[model samples]
Target: DADRNGFVMGEGAAVLVLEDLEHARARGADVYCEISGYATFGNAYHMTGLTKEGLEMARAIDTALDMAELDGSAIDYVNAHGSGTQQNDRHETAAVKRSLGAHAYATPMSSIKSMVGHSLGAIGSIELAACVLAMSHQVVPPTANYTTPDPECDL
Candidate 1:
């Protein structure tokens, strides 16, 4: 479990079959959803540390939303990068709130790592699969090991 202090390292692999909507539709492919937006930014502050205010992360998220032409209120779910470390959990929650404001609390966010354990660099693909599965099954996968809420991560 990843909720204790740090994540349990694990090994896994996932492959997402993506195609252009027109090509998929022509071939009768089952399209899940579209990747409407993407953005990236480097903090360059630390290899193992994040900014205290999480402004850089928030900026990246904001950029994504702007690219998608969507507002925070339009967000339905948040698939968080919850590494299960004290610093990461707190910082991620705070960053979401900073980016999405009151809508952050309205959105149901969860961490797949809590259930499947962390797979390091492979996590993003796995988490995206989790999101697609949740959408397909209409379920919000529980944060498996979560129990008490920390004051620092009051999301």
Candidate 2:
């Protein structure tokens, strides 16, 4: 309980090859899939604390979905950037619900950090790999070490 804020530190790196569908097809390269859209933004709310409602992260998710020309219902799984921090976990769950509305409850969301620990910024690349693997296998990886869901993180 005391270590709820603690995270396991890990070391790793991942390199992704991104190419346009037409370009990959023209070159006869085996394409994993096309990245339809993406978005990024910084929350000026606080250094260590998030805003009360996690609106900024929700905005990022909404923007990404808008860019992809997809609705929240289209999303089947969410590869969360779960760092094993209680605050972050709750905030992220709130953000997902805010952005996806009702779809958030139906969609499966998981954090890979529980398995490999927190890699800091490098976790993004590793998570991307996990996403690809999930896609290839058509399975959603479970949140390791998770017993009971926190009421604060209903999503």
Candidate 3:
């Protein structure tokens, strides 16, 4: 719940410790994994809504993979911001499949939105936390209220 009554706002913060592979190894730091690459893009079509084609989003994922020198098949998990909204879910699925091709279906993925609702600005970090927790526990969080699955969202 919000601390004040103006609007229901969720808030939190996260910090990650990162270093070069060799540096981490030399220190004997237990590394969870490496952040190979990342890409960001805006949906010019709409400020609050993502484009249905997901062309821009797909390109962003592709660019990240390319920069990481990794193939789509190498991805074991995808931490999607599954907002449970029609457009967002559909577009994200399309973008992922476009970037990962057939490997997208085989890879396990999940969204924390269903469990905690949208936390606005903190959503990304919360979702990342869910991913980290999943990795640590070796279990995927259930997509609560996910009934009558949409075929378009194969993941």
Which 10-residue window of candidate 2 scores lowest in summed lDDT?
1-10
Report the C-alpha lDDT of model 3 over 25-70, residue by residue, as the tens digit: 9999988767888899876687878877778889999999999999
Tens digit per residue, CA lDDT, model 1, 1-155:
22368888967978899888899999999888888988887778888788667787788889999999998888889888888888777778878899899999889998888888889889889899889989888898888878777777766
Q: Write candidate 2's Cα lDDT for 1-155 as tens digits.
A: 21456579988989988877888899999776667778887776778877647687888888999999998889999998777677777778888999889999999988888888888888898899889889888999888877776777775
Candidate 2 vs candidate 3: the TM-score winner is 2
TM-score for candidate 2, please give it: 0.92
> Which prediction has the highest lDDT against the true structure?
1
Note the Cα lDDT for every prediction shown: 0.84, 0.82, 0.76
List where candidate 3 sits over 4 angstroms from the true fold: 1-11
* Higher-TM-score candidate of 1 and 2: 1
- 1 versus 2: better lDDT goes to: 1
Model 3 clash pairs?
A: none
lDDT, candidate 3, equals 0.76
Full-model lDDT, candidate 2: 0.82
